[model samples]
Target: MWRIDFFLDNGYENVSMNDIVKHAGGSLATLYKHFGNKEQLFIYILEQKSEEVFGEWGRKSVCYEGRIEEFLTETGRMFLDLVTTPDAILFHRLLISIGYINDSRLNKTQIQNLMSVPVIIIANYLENEKVNGHIEVEDTYLVAEQFLNAVKGPFLFQTILGIQIDISEETRLKALKQVVTIFCRGLHVIQ
Candidate 1:
């Protein structure tokens, strides 16, 4: 797992099963049998990573049910942490860079689908929050986009454009808190 991540981080384009076999110190036959192909392996890795994050999110959200402030506070903190995490940002940048390039192994549809995972997860969380009476929004999709934009816009701009800016933990927490607060205002249920 670390080998594949390292290779991707090192800007290896068109990572193949052979590459995985050599880098991962595993047999090509075993890699093929387990993951089928490079695309499958990538998707599998993404799923594993998503599970690691969302599993904790699930537990925490459920535990903090009925308390929108606490839920959003915890969620925002965790989410900002995830967004700024080195591994998460690196993998995200790699995916964005590779997603547009034509790979012989994975087609356009598969890549598009993989890229939509984040939006899907965000929308699902917003929908769940709404159902739990945490926030009231007419459109979860748009709300999800806004939520993502609030969190990702600055980080991605700096990352992709090489804009040097001091990003402190305190700044991240403040940004996250503001995003949640503004979003909650827009989504608050009318009494």
Candidate 2:
């Protein structure tokens, strides 16, 4: 919690274990004991934040069992909302900026895990739909990734690059609907 706040306020590269201990009023040994190291703590913070943003969707719940379209629409909207936030953009930028630094606390595996949460959740839903014969996807992972990118790509890039400050809810919904339509049509074909 404190670590997340500290990281957000001070940036990932700027914050250190000592700073976290000082601000959090905890011992370094305790922090290390609980989180293993800075990378682990950072990953934990990411997991917590993802859960907060995505709610039960982040955990692969089967809430959309009989309604694939509803699931895609809701998940697309939520994913767009999460990634377009200023805080999310800043966090992503921070991660990308420091990702290649020598001996960086964040590593490829940790970053992949953080990125994989939504994909995994979406893939689980897709797998369920496939089982029900509602859709046919040879690779749920690829489909999930494509669906996410279609939903998040335009707005996320614009927000991250300062090209667009904010997108209207109407625009967001329309785009999401368009993507869901395209994806559903493609997946509903006889196979």
Instruction: Give the candidate number with the greatest lDDT.
Output: 2
Candidate 1 positional error at 70, Å: 2.3
lDDT of 2 by residue, 51-159 (tens): 7766677454576676878889989988888787778788777776777578775777877877888888898888878888878889998999999999987688777
Q: Give the TM-score of candidate 1.
A: 0.81
In model 1, the runs with Cα more than 4 Å from the true position are 1-3, 12-14, 107-125, 132-134, 189-191
Residue range 50-105, candidate 1, lDDT tens digits: 66667666655456545555666676666667777666667667766776666544
Global fold similarity of model 2 (TM-score): 0.88
Highest TM-score scorer: 2
Count of steric clashes across candidates, in order: 0, 0
